[model samples]
Target chain A: VSLNLAFEEAPLRGSISFISQSGTLGNYLMLLARAKGYSFRAFVSSGNQAVLEATDFLEYFGQDEGTKAIILYLEGLQDASRFAKVVRNIVPQKPILIYKAGRFDVGVRAALSHTASIAGNDRIFDSFCQQVGLIRCYDPLHTFDMAVALTTQPLPKGKRVAIISGGGGYCVTMAEAACAWGLEVPTLDYATAQKIKEILHPFAPFPLNPVDAASDVRPMTYARVIDILMGLDYIDGVFMMIPFMFEFQLRSAAAIRELVDATEIICGLPAKYGKPILGNMIPRVSVGPALDLFQKAGIPFFATQDESARAMSGLVRYAQIISLAKEVPFSAEKPRFPRADQPIAYVSRVDPVNIPERD
Target chain B: VSLNLAFEEAPLRGSISFISQSGTLGNYLMLLARAKGYSFRAFVSSGNQAVLEATDFLEYFGQDEGTKAIILYLEGLQDASRFAKVVRNIVPQKPILIYKAGRFDVGVRAALSHTASIAGNDRIFDSFCQQVGLIRCYDPLHTFDMAVALTTQPLPKGKRVAIISGGGGYCVTMAEAACAWGLEVPTLDYATAQKIKEILHPFAPFPLNPVDAASDVRPMTYARVIDILMGLDYIDGVFMMIPFMFEFQLRSAAAIRELVDATEIICGLPAKYGKPILGNMIPRVSVGPALDLFQKAGIPFFATQDESARAMSGLVRYAQIISLAKEVPFSAEKPRFPRADQPIAYVSRVDPVNIPERD
Candidate 1:
C-alpha cells in the first residue's frame, strides 16, 4: 500500500493530535470538539495499531512546541509500560489528559464491535495515569473545559470560592457545588459585612456570601454582587449565573446575539481582575445565539447551568493538581511492532479461562 | 380486555395526572415530578390515540374535580377539530397545559417512531392552540412551571411586568423578553429611583423597568429591590432571577429560603396598601431544598430563570384570552372505525384522474 507523508517540514508543529483504537469514538469526539469549538493539533484514527503505536505519537507530540495538551481516547493499551513511559515524558513539558473508554462490559462490547479488538482491565490504566501525572477528563465537555482553563486563568492557590447571585438558591447551589468540588465557602467578617451593607439592602443582610438578589432588580445587581464577592479575603473564585436577556424575547436573533455579547463582556470582566469567573449562562434557550461568544471568549459555557458548573469543577480540580505537583515526560524509546509469528487475539479477555470468577 | 379503572376513583384525588404518547418522555417527566416531591393522580400512556385519546382523558380530568390541572405530552392531532373543541371546553373550568413535543423535524421523527403514528405539522397545532385557549409549554420543565403559575398566582390584569435581577445581562434579557412578549416594562420615576439608590449602588442605574439592585450587599437587598420595582406605576407582574444558593451550602438553605420568603412577604405587603401583588415571583434557582418553602409561601420558583420567564409569558397570554373568551370543555366525540368491508387501494395525489380521464 502506498501513502502520502503529508508533513515534510517541521512535522507535528500544529493542532491537537489524538490516537484512538475505536474510530466510532474518534468520530464522536471529533464531532463533539467541532460542536464545542475546540482546536486540535491533529486527530489520527489509529486503527489496529499493528504498525504505528500510541507511544510513537506521544513522543513526537511531547517535544512539539505548538501542542499545549495531548488528549487520549483509549479503549485499551497495546503495551501498558510503554504507554506509561510516553505519558510520563510528555507531562513535564505539556499536560496529558486521558479519557479511557471500554472500562465496563458494555463499553468493551462496543469497542469489540467498533475496532475488532478486546479491551483490557481499566484499573491498570487508571493507576498508570495517576502515577504518570496525566489529567483524566471524565467527559468530553470536561476535557475541553480543562483545556480552556489551562489556556486562560492562572492556577488558583487554593479552592476557596464565593458565589454572588440575584437568587439565594443559585448562590447556595454554587456554594454546595464548590464544596463538593473540594472548595471552601467561609463566612465574611463583621467589617466586610458592613462594607457590603453600604452598597446592598439593609434587609438583604451583610455577609451574604452568595448574594441572592430578587427578580424585580436590574442587571447591574450581578456586576455589583460580583464586585463585593471578589473583594472578600477568602474567595479564590466566583461562580455566577447570568440570564440570557434575548432568550426571554424568543423573537429577534439580533437581540439574542447582543445579549450574549454583552453577557460575555460583563461576565468576562472578573477575569480582568485576575479572578476566575465561572458563569452559568447556558444557551439552552437557543443554541445559535451565544455559542460563538463562548467559543471566542474561551469560556466553558454550555447548554445547561449544571454543565457549566460541572465543567468549572473539573477545571478547578485540575488547576489544583497542577499547582501541587510537577508531571514527568515520556522517555526516548524506539517503536516496537508485534511479531508476525505471535497470534494477535482480538477477543483476548472474553475467552473462558481469562474470565474472572466474581461473586 | 378488562382494564382496571382505579385511576378514575375519587380516592386518587390531589395527585398528578400524566398523559403522554412517548413512554420515555412520560417516564422522564414522572421522574422530575417525583424528584420534586409531587405524587401522581394517574400516569396514563395515550398510545397512538388508537385507544384512549388525549381529548378523552383531558375531558375526564376537567369534570372529575379531583384534577387540579391536566398536563399533556402531545405530539400531533388525530382529529384537530375534536382536540381544539375539547381543549376550549375544559380550559376555563380547568387549566390544560400541554408539553407539545414535535416542534422541529427531528422532534417530529422521534415522536412518530416512538408512538408508531404520524405527528401532524407543528405550525398547524400552534395556530390551533392560539385559536382556542390551549396553554403551550416549551418543554417538560415549563409544563410544570405553567401549572404552578396557574395554581398559585391570581390572574394578572395586564401585560405590564417588573423584572428584578442582580446582573445587567439578566435584567436586560428580562426587559427585552417582556417587551417581545408584548408585556409592558414601565420605567421607574425619579422618586422611586432615588429611594432605591439609598439601598442600591450609585452606578446601579435603576433602568426604570428592570430594578437592578446592582449588588449583593445583603439579603435585605432582595426585599428593597422587590419593594422599589413593585411600587412603580403600571407594572402588573414581576419576574425575578435569584442566584443558586443552596447548591453551594446545605447549611445556608434555610437562610436562602428565609431570604426568598421575606421577599415574597414584602411583595405581598403592597396588597395591604390596596396595590395588590399583580405579577409573579420566579426565583431562577432549582427547587431541590426550598421547594416546601416556596410552595407554602406562595412564591412560584423555577429551576431555570428562562423557564420561569417563559411561564410568566404564557400566563400573561393566557389571561388575555381568558378575559376575551368563555371557558372551554373537552369534546364528547368518539373515534369511529372505518367501513368494515372495503377495498383498500393505495391512493396517490400525483395520479388524481382514473381510466375515465385519459386512456
Candidate 2:
C-alpha cells in the first residue's frame, strides 16, 4: 500500500524520517502523525526490505538536507556493520530514534510468528543506540510525542526535573519512573517550598520535586505551583501529571480547563525563558478533552510515565544532535549504494493500487 | 457501519446467539464465526449498553425460541443480580459463555479508557459466573473455538490428557499448563511406548505422556505417537504441540501439509472410537498455516498455553451446563422488556441525517 504522511516536504528539507515494516502499522502511524501534525520529512514502509536494505535507507536519510532526525520500526536487519556505520555518520549530523520490535521474548515470538523473522541480539542494539546518540522510543505514540519535544524544546542543562500532579498517586508514579530513567529529583529551595506550602494544606508535605497539590486544587493553585517549580534554578524541566478521574460536569470541566490553561501558559513561559516542560498526562483514558486544551496550546502530552521520560530524553538528545550537526563536516565523497544493480524487489512485488485496498 | 454475520438459519431455527460490546471486537468475532460457518440463531450489539442492560438482553435471549446457548462480552454490568438470575435460570436449559473484561487491574483501567465503562467488583462477578454455570473463557479466539468444540464434539469422559510434541521444550510447556488446568498426564504403558519406538529411534526414552519424538521425526512418527496416545484407555484428550520450525524452506509447505493431514486423521479417529480430543496448539506464533487445517478438522487451536487451558476448560464447563440442562426443567416464562417510558438521554443526541461530520 502507498504510505501517507503528514508532510509532503522533500527528504532534505530538515532530518527525521520514520520507516515502518508493517503496512497496517504504517497507516496507523500516519493517522496519529496527522492528528499530532508533526513536521516529519518523510514516512516510508520498507516491506520485507529485501532489496532496499535498512543500511541503504539509513545512509540516504543521513545525508538528506531536510532531514533532522530519523525514526524506525525494525523487523530484522541485513547488515549490522553498514547499519552501525550509517548511524555513526548520522549521529554526528542528526539524531535517529528507533523502536526495535522483538526486544522482549514474547515480542520475538510474535515477530517470528508473523514473518519468521530472526530476532537478533536486542540488548546489544539498545546499547548500540546509546553509543551512537540515537534516541530509542518504546511505541509509535511515544515516537511522535518525542519528535515534538525534540524538535521544539532545547537541551536541558541538567537532569533536575520538577513534577506536579493533580492527584497524589500519579505524581508518585511519575517520580518513580523518572528516577528510573536517570532524571534527578533535586530538592527545591526553602523559599520555593514555603510558596508551595502557602497554597497546600499543613497535613500534606511539600516535597522537593514531585509536588502533589491534592485533587481539590483550583486553577490558580496550578499556576502558582508551576511558577514555584519553574523558579527553581536546579530544575531543568517540569512534568505535570493529571488524571481523568473527574466527571464531565460543567464546574469540573471549567476547573479542568483552568488547570490545563494555566499549565499551558506556564509551559509557554518556560519556552519564553530557557527551560523545558514535559507534561505527563497519567490515567490517560478519559483525559482526552482536558489534554486537547494543553495540546492546542503547544504542550506535548504523554500517556505513560515511561513515555514521558522517553520524550524528555529525546528532546535532550535531539538538542545535542543539532549542536553536533553544527560542528561535524559532511563527507567529501558520497557513499556508494550497495546492491545498486539489484532489481527493486519492493517495487516488483508491490501494486500501489492493490496496496491501498488492503488498508 | 452495518454489522456482518453468517447464519445457517434464522433465530427461530434453535441455535446459539452471540453478542459483543465493541463494534471492532464484535466484527472480528463475526468474521471468525462466518469463516467457521457457525449456525448461530442470532447476533446482536448493545452499543454502549447504557440504557438497555446486559440482563435485559440475556432475558430476551433466554426466552427466544431458537437460542440454545448465549455468548457475551461483559465489559461492565448494569444490574449484576438481574444478569445473574437470568443466567441462573438459563443454566438448566440454555448454556451461556462469558468473556468478562476488567478482571485484572490493568484490564479494568483499559476498559474504562476504551469504552468509558466503570468496571465494578470483578471478583464477585467471577464467583457468580461459576455459581450460575456461566462458562468463563480467557482468550477471545479460544472462546470462539470452544463454542465450535462444544457444539460439535461430545464431552470428554475425564480429564486424562496426553501430549504429543515435536520437541521437549514445547511438550514441557504444554504439560505444565495442562496439569495446572486439572488434566492428568498418564504414564504411557510399555506396549504403547514400544509402538512409538517402532516409528522413531527406539533408544531415545519417550518423555512419558508428551511423547516427544525429537527433532528428526517424520510425519509417520507423529501419526504413530498419536496412535499410541489415543489407544491408551486412560487418555481422554490429546494435546498436539507442533512447532513449524522446519517450514521455513519453500518446499517445507508440503511436509507441514503432510504432518497436519496425519494429525487430523488421527484426532478424528479418536472421536469415531468414542474418545474426544482437546488439541493444544503450542507456542502460537509458530502455528502458521496449520491453524486453518486444524480448524477445518474440528480440532481446537490455541495461540498461548493459558489460552489452550482456557479453551479446554470452557468446553468442559459447557459439557457440565449441557448435563445440567438435561436434568432441570425450564418453564416457558413470559419475556419482559425495560420500561419504555423511562427517560433516556443521548438516544436522539446524534441524528444520523444531520449530525456534524467527524474528521
Candidate 3:
C-alpha cells in the first residue's frame, strides 16, 4: 500500500520488528530507526485489519527468533483481551513496545477519522499495557529509543549503572537522569579509583561515581574506564559518554589505528562482563566519522543523556518484567484469524549475526 | 589556553551566547547546535575564573545587543549572591539558561577536582532558580532545546497550543506531550474546524486540537492549515509537523515551488500572528533541503515531541517569569568585580536580519 512512499530502502537486517496501522507513519518510523543504526526484521502495515490484525502478527513474531524487539505504531487494539493474553505469554521471553496513538479525546477523534479503530479510554489502555507487561512509548522516536537497548545490548542484572565521562558536564546530566530513572550511580571503590587515577592525566579529576576523567580524556581513556567499571561486582551496566570528536583531528594512520584499538576494547566489554554499555555525547551530536567506528563495532551511541539513561533503565525494568513473567504460566493458543495460504510478507529466518552473544 | 581544540570555526553570527567553565564541553555544544542550524553570538571559556569569571561574562552579555539568549555551562558559583542579583535583573529582559553541574555528592566530588570551586546543595540551586525566574536546564543539549525557541520565536501569551500534522501518529505523539507539559490542546470550534475541513483532502480526518490533515496533506496544505490555526481566537501558538518528503519525489521545478511557498507561510507565522510556530517531524529527523528553506527564514525546528513541548513550555513559563518580574520593584546593583582593561573577546553587535520582529 505504501509502495508509493518517498523512500524505497533496501532491507538492512537487524533484531527489531514493527507493526503499524498507518503505512505512512510506519515509513516515518523506519527512516528514523535506520538513522539511529537500527534495521527492522520485518514491517507489517496492518491496513484496516479486515482479516489478519496487529496481535495476530504480534503472536507470530513473539516466537520468531529474529524479532528480539517488537514495535507497534498503534491506533487501537483489534482484540484487547486477545492482545493481553498473547503479550503476557511473549513478554516473558521478548520485548514489545507500543506507540499508542489517540491517548486523549482530541487525538481519539483524529484516530477515528484516519482509521476505523476504536481508541478506548486512554488511562485504561495504559494500565492494561502495564498489566500485560508491554512497554508503552509516548512518541514514535521514543519507541526506537527504548527499543534499541533491548535489541542490541545484554540486559543488566540490576539497577546499578556506572557512568563514565570525558567531560564533567555529562556526569552531572546523566547522573541526574539516571537517579530520576531509578538507577543507582554508585561511587567507585578506593581500589578502583586508584587504578583509574594511575591511568589518567595528572591534571584530571579524581574518579568517583560518574568516573569523571575530565581533561584526562583520550581515544583510549573510554576503553580503560569501561574495563575497570565492568570488572566491578556491584555494577550491572555502564552508561557512559565518549569524546571521539576530541580525537577527530588525528587523521594520521597511527591515530586512526589507536581509535580502532580503543573501539575493540569498548565494544567487547558488554559481552565480556555480561552487562550493557550505552555510549553518548554530552551535547547529543550524531555527526563525525569517529562515531562510525563504534557503530560498526555494534556499540550504538545514544544522542542525549536522558535517552542513554532512559535506555539503560529500559534494560533494568525489562529485567524485572522478564523475571515476573517466569512466575506466570504461559497459555498457548491457536490464531483466531486463519492464516492466508500465501506466506507472510518479507519476514525471513533468524539471523544470529545481528545479536551479541552473552558469555 | 585551549587553542589546540580540533576544528577552527568561522563566526556564524546569531542570537544565542554561551559561557562555560569547560572549553571542551562548550565546543561539543556548539558542534551540535550548528548541526541543528544555530550559530553562536559569543563563546567565553571561563578558565579558572582568575580575573574575569563566568558571572562577569554573563553580566556583559546580559547587556550585549547580540546575546538574545544566554546559556551557562556552570560548575559552581564563585559569588552566589552577586550572581543572583545580576541574573534577576537580566532574566526579565533576556533569558539566562543554566545547566548546573555538581548536583549530587558523586558529581560534587568530580567537580571539586575538575575546578577549584565549592559545590553547594542541589535542591537549593533548583529552588533558587525557580524563585529568581531563571530557567535551569537538566542537560547540556537541553540548554539549546529551550534556548532556541526563546531566541528565534515570539513569546507565547498563554499555554494554548494547536498541533497540526501530516501524519495522525504525530498528532497523537505531540498532543500527548503538549498536555503532559501543561500546555492546553483545546479542540477547535465548529466554525473554525469547518473552515479547516473545507481546505483539507475530502477523505482526511476532521480538524480538531491536533488538526490532523492525515492523507489530505500537501505542500500547500501546511500553509493553509497554519494560516487558520495561527489566526484562531483561542490559539496562543502552533506546534506542527510537516512531511515535505511526501512531495519529495517530484523533482520538477513545480514541486520545489510548492514546498518553498509552504516554508514562507510556516516561517512567517510567528511574526504574522504575534505567536510562535515550532515545526517538527514525527520520528525527529534533521535531513532534507526542504528544511534549509525554513532555516533560512529564521525558524528553528525542535527534534522530539518531548523537546518541542518542553521548548514551548519554556516560552510559556518565561512569559510568566517576565510578568512576575514586572510586578516586583527593580533594585539596580553594581558589578562587584572590575572589568578587563582590554576589550572583551569577540563580543560584537547583533545583526537584526536574524530575529523575526513580532510586529
Candidate 4:
C-alpha cells in the first residue's frame, strides 16, 4: 500500500530523487522540501521492504535517465555487502547522500523494533560510506540543505570562494565559517581590487577578499563587482551575504526592492558563467516580502552564513569527487536480491477510530 | 534618539536582560525574541558609546534586583579590565551570557567601524570569558535560545536526561545528540521500565532510557511516564521529544489539540515537582497552532534535538557553576573607570528623507 500527499499543486521537476524507508519521514521531507522551494524528479517510500529493499531502489535510480543525484534515509541494512557493492557501482555515476538514523545503543534497539532490521556497527558503516563515496548528513534539515544546493547550483571547480557583504560583521563571520568549512577565501589581486574600488564610495575601505561593500546599498555597485569577480579565472564561486533587515533599516521598501533586483542579477551570473553563486539573507518579518522575491526567483537564500558556507563547501567537495571518479576505472556488477512484482502496497484504508479531539 | 517598536502588546515579564552594542542588532534581536516567545525585563542599546560603555550597563544590571540573567552582544571593549571585574562579580550571582562578534580579522575590522571600538585579541577575550564563568554563545539565535531556557525552566542539577519520543529514529538521534552535548542518557532501571511497559502496547518494545513511544499516541501514557520519571530522585531533567507533526497526521485537528493540552499538563509538572522539562516539536505549518499553545503556556519547545540538548546542557553547566560559586569565597572589588554625567545621547530629530515605498 502507498500513502501519498502533495503539498503543492505544481512541484518543480528536477534530477534529484529521494528514497525514504519510513513513510512518516518521507512526508516530513516532502513538507520541508516544499517549504524551502526544493524540487525533485521522483520519491520512493520503501516501507517494510516486504519484497524490495533500500538497495533495490538505489540501483534502480542509479540507471534512471532522469535522476542525477540519489538521497537515502536508511534505518538499517538487511544486506550490508550487497548494499556496499551497489553503492560502489553507483558512486562513480551519480552522487549518493545518506542519513543513517540508528547510531547509539538505545537507537539500535528502537530501530530493530521499528523496522525489524538490525543496525550494524555505526563506525564500520561510516568507514564503508566514506570508502564508497557517500555524503553522510547528520540532520534531516542539513541533508535537504545540501541536496537543494547540489541540484540547483553549478558545482564549484575549486574551494576558492569570494565573499561580498554589505555589512562588515557578516563578512567577518562568513570568512571564519568559510575557513572552518574548508573553503579558502583568497585575497583579491591588486588589479581586481583596484577595479572594485572605482565602483565603491570614496569613504568605503579598499576592497579585500571578503569585499565588505559596507554602506554601499546601490544595486549596480554590487552587480558590477560580482560580475567582475565571477569573470576572474581563480574565483570558483561567490557567497553574497545580503543583510536584508539592515538594508530595510537604512533604506525604504523601494530601495530594498532594488536590492532584491540586484540579488537576482548576481544569482543569474552562476548560470551564465558556470560558477555557483549562493545568497545569505537573515530571516526577518519586515523583509518577508523581499525574501519572498528571492525565493520566487529560485535563488538559494541561506538563513545563516555557516549554512551557506557549508552548502558551498559541499558543492566543492562533490565536484572534487566527480573529478577523481573520472580517473578511476569501474566495472558494473549488479548484486542479486529478492524482487517482487510490486514494490509498494497502497493501502487506501485509513484508521477509522479517532481519538477525542480537544477544544 | 531610540527607535522603539513593540511587536507584541502583552509581553511576558521576566528576569532576563539584554545589552546590545548596535541598535540595529537590538531591533533584530527583539523581533526574534518576540517570534520565539522570549521575554525580557529590559534591553539597552549602548550606541556609539558616546558616554556609557557596555560595562556600565553590565554594572547596572549586576546590581538590579529584578535581573536574574544577563545577555550581552559585544562588538568591542573600551575597558577590558573593568569589564572583567564586573563580569566576575556578576557571574557568582547570575548567569552572564555573551555573544562577542568580530572574532576573526575581518570581523575585528568590521567591529571597529560599526561601533568605533577596538576589537581586542580574541584569544585573550576567550580566556577572560572562561575565567569569569561566562557562557559564550556563537550566534544571536543561540544566545536567545539559551536565555529562554534559563528564564523558563528550573536549573538541571545533573547531566542525566531521559529522552522520550514517538519515533524510533528521533529517539536514536536525540540520544546521540544528548550524549554529544554532555548530557548523559542513562538506561532505565528495571522497575521504571516495568512501569512504562504496563502503559505501552504489547507490540511495542520494552521501555528504555530513550523511550521509543512508537505507535502510541495516547497523551496520558506520555504524561504518566513523564510524571513518574521526573519524580525519580536519580533523574535530573527530561528532554521530551514530541513530534506533534506526526500526531497531526495520524489524528484529526481536534485530536492534535488534545495532544497539545496533554503537553500543557506535562509542562505544568516541571514547576510543581521542581524538575526541568524541555519540549521539542519540529517547526511545521500544520502544527503551528499546537506549537502556539505550548508557547502561550511559557514552555520552551526547541526545533531540533541538538538545540534542545544544547540548551539543557547549558542549564546543567550553569547550575554547576552556581553551585561551585557558593562554596568559594568571593571578594567584592570595583574597578576604576571614567565617569560622565550624561551617559546617553537621545537624538530627537528623525531623518526627513524617506525612500519611496515599493508597490
| Highest DockQ scorer | 3
The CA lDDT at A139 in model 2 is: 44
Displacement of residue A296 (Cα, Å) in model 2 is: 2.8
Best by lDDT: 3
- What docking class should model 4 receive? incorrect
Preferred candidate (TM-score higher): 1 or 2: 2
Q: Write the per-residue lDDT of candidate 2 for residues B1-359, one digit (tens) a residue.
A: 11123232233222567776664445435554543345456667664676676677788888876665678876677766677667777766666777766544434544453455676766565545544667765434445655655654556666677766654434444554554454556777788766777776654444456566555446656666676677677877677755432344125667767766665676566567565665543232233455565555666554444345545555555655555455545433321211112111112111111111112
DockQ score for candidate 3: 0.16
Backbone clash pairs for candidate 3 read: none
lDDT of 4 by residue, B171-279 (tens): 6667766664556777889999999989877877787777878758777778888888888778889988665545343467667666767767786878877878888
lDDT of 1 at A359: 21
Report the C-alpha lDDT of model 3 over B1-359, residue by residue, as the tens digit: 11222236643677888888877667767776776666777777785678889888889888888789989988889898889888987987899888877555655665665676666887667656765767766567767877888888899888899988777767776787776566778889999989989988887777777887866537788798888889987999998777774445256787777777777777788898999988776334444566777777667676667678878877887776776577656654532222223221111111100111112
> Which candidate number has the best TM-score?
3
lDDT of 4 by residue, A1-359 (tens): 12122223334576677888776556556655665556777777786688888899999889887787788988888888788888877876777888776555655665676677677887666555544667766555556667767867888788788888776556656776665465767778899999999998887767877887766767778888999989889999898865543434346767766676776777578888899888876454435344665555555877666678767766876776566556545533321211212211011000000111212
Report the lDDT tens digits of candidate 2 across residue range A5-50: 3234222222357776654345445554543345556777675566
Candidate 4 wrong stretches, greater than 4 Å: A1-15, A29-34, A37-43, A243-264, A284-298, A331-359, B1-16, B22-50, B63-68, B102-118, B243-264, B284-293, B331-359
TM-score of chain B of each: 0.69, 0.65, 0.84, 0.80
Q: What is the per-residue lDDT of model 1 for residues B1-359, given as tens digits with 9 covering 90 to 100?
A: 11113223121223346676554335445545543334456666675667788788777777765566678877666877777777777766666777665544434443443344466666566545555656665445556656666655656666667766554334543454344334556666778767776776666654455665553435567566676666555766677654424344244657666666665655464454333232322223334433454455455554333345555666665565565454332333421111112111111110100111111
Clashes of each: 78, 13, 0, 6
- Could you give the candidate ranking by lDDT, starting with the highest? 3, 4, 2, 1
